[model samples]
Target: MGALMLKEIRSFLNSITGYLVIVVYLLINSFLLWMFPGVFNILEGSYASIDSLFLVSPWVFMFLIPAITMRMFADEKKAGTMELLLTRPVTDMQIVLSKFSAGFILVLFSILPTLIYYVSVYQLGNPVGNIDNGGAFGSYIGLLFLGASYVSIGVFASSLTENQIVAFLIGVFLCLFMYIGFEQMSELNLFGNADLFILSMGISEHYTSMSRGVLDSRDMLYFISLIVFFSLATRLVIQSRKW
Candidate 1:
């Protein structure tokens, strides 16, 4: 599993697409937060906050993560190596987790560079340190969990098909739905008193709670459950090959 995980990570770093994805992710956020004159612009807001980074990253990940994970299993199956991979000593779950961990680490690599934004914001604070450290920290945590959830979903999507394009499309749809579809559905008031319950089913609500600097265990649990659920789902997909 560890070897497979390392190979997956190395494959990403050795490829131009991997570097391009990370670069694009950072460039978009930087332009929105510093250059573009709008609500997301920190300079224009005259406030020392990195909230814009948190606000924009999940949306960015909706596409970027799918791009990253689309070929994990799809390429293997395309190349006829998936059968060889299954014969390896690793369990199906281990294989799924190895790929998931590699994708999550890549997501972390993209996110870590944004800390420069946090440091700049910290220094730019009116008092040179007036920034909400707790909120910033919690938001970072939330972002990591959100990225993990996306990676898990992407991995599962990849396992469902041998075509990378199909996997990418499925991953994007699932990420978008998990992130906001539930919240939007609840807004229609069709669920009656279950509206709040419906809203809670989406990632946005828990992500919003964590962004407020509150470390709620329920939010953490929600993210963990998402990751685990998708990981297990991917394993089941892989197992389906034998049937």
Candidate 2:
């Protein structure tokens, strides 16, 4: 499992695609945080916070993660490498796990560079380091969970199809739905008491909650369950090849 994990990690890092994903994610966020003259801009606000980056990155990962992981299993199957992998001593679950870990790590790496934003904000605080350290720290944790969940969805989507593009599209739409669809559903008055409950079920709700420096157990469970569910789905999808 560790060996497969390393190989998958190496393949992503060795290829231009990995760097491209990181670069694009960073570039987009940097532009929005620094250059864009919109509501999210810090310059327009009275304080300096990386709140903008965190807010927008969830949406960004909705697309970037899928694009990055779409090929993990899809290309392997398309190139006949998946069968070759199966011939080894690894089980379908291990293969899925290895790829999932690799993809999630890559996604984590892509977000880590944004820590510079955190440091800068801390230093730039009027009273120097007056920023909400707790909130910022919690927000970072929330971001990691969000990225991890997104990567799992990517792995699951990739396992379902040999066409990488289709995998990417499927992953993006599914993630978007989980991230916002439930929350949006709550906007309607139909559910009444159930409305807020359903909205809290979405990834965004939990993510936003954690961003406020409140580490709720329910939120953590939501994140873990998401990762596990998608990983299990990916394993099953690959096992179906035997049928």
- How accurate locally, in lDDT, is each candidate? 0.96, 0.90
lDDT per residue for candidate 1 within 1-243, as digits (tens), equals 999999999998999999999999999999999999999999987678999899999899999999999999999999999999999998999999999999999999999999999999899999999898989999999999999999999999999999999999999999999999999999999999999999999999999999887899999999999999999999999999989
lDDT of 2 by residue, 97-146 (tens): 89988988898889889988888888888999978888888898899999
Whole-model alpha-carbon lDDT for candidate 1: 0.96
How high is the lDDT of residue 105 in model 2? 87
Off by over 4 Å in 1: none
> What TM-score does candidate 2 reach?
0.96
Model 2 Cα RMSD, Å?
Answer: 1.3
CA deviation > 4 Å runs, candidate 2: none
